[model samples]
Target: MDTQKLTIRLPESDVQFIKRFAEEHKTTVTEMIRRYLKQLQAQHIDEADAALQSITGLLPQNITEADTRRLYADYMMDKHR
Candidate 1:
């Protein structure tokens, strides 16, 4: 994978601990941080998908275009009130 250099500052003690942890775990500090960020990205995608599904499930199975427009118009009217 393509990678770029990123610089971050941490307390000396924290940095030392991370180095020890990485050595014991057979990985690097950069790898651990990358995995953590990937987890957050995955969770965000899952949450977004769930939100979309909930909205889609609210509508009828055979709703027509006219019905959709009417519903949207009603929602807009209520929102402005």
Candidate 2:
């Protein structure tokens, strides 16, 4: 995949820590940061999936199409008000 260059600024202490940790693992700081970000993204996906499961448990098991429409309309109206 194509990627663009990006620059960021962080504390000197944080940079030193990342550099040392990356050296220990034999990788660059950029790669370490990317891996950390991917792990966080996976964690967020897991949390969102759990929330969806909880919502499914709260909703009826056999909602008809009309019931779905009414529920959507009610939710929208309540949210707007």
Candidate 3:
């Protein structure tokens, strides 16, 4: 795959820390950043999936027209109370 170059400015302390971390891990800072980004993306996907799962069964299926009307009526009544 083709790759592009990116330039970023960091504080001297951060740069030193990243260099030490990369040396300790036997990986380049670029690879470390890429791994971190992948982790962040995975975390977001997990959170979104959890949110969708939480609402999956909030409403019942197989409701008739009468049931729908009754549900709406109850909602309106509760809203006004």
- Best model per lDDT: 1
Candidate 1: segments with Cα more than 4 A from true spot: 75-81
Residue 72, candidate 1: Cα error in Å is: 3.2
Query: Model 3 segments beyond 4 Å from truth?
Result: 64-74
TM-scores for all predictions: 0.76, 0.69, 0.74
* Candidate 2: tens digits of C-alpha lDDT, residues 11-71: 9999899899899989998787788999999999999999988887676789888999999
TM-score of 3: 0.74
Each model's lDDT: 0.95, 0.90, 0.94
lDDT, model 2? 0.90
Query: Which predicted model would earn the best TM-score?
Result: 1
Sort the predicted structures by TM-score, highest score first: 1, 3, 2
lDDT of 1: 0.95
21 Cα displacement, candidate 2 (Å): 1.7
* Lowest-sum lDDT 10-residue window in model 2: 52-61
- Better model by TM-score, 1 or 3? 1
Please give the TM-score that candidate 2 achieves against the real structure.
Answer: 0.69
What is residue 56's positional error in candidate 1, in angstroms?
Answer: 2.6
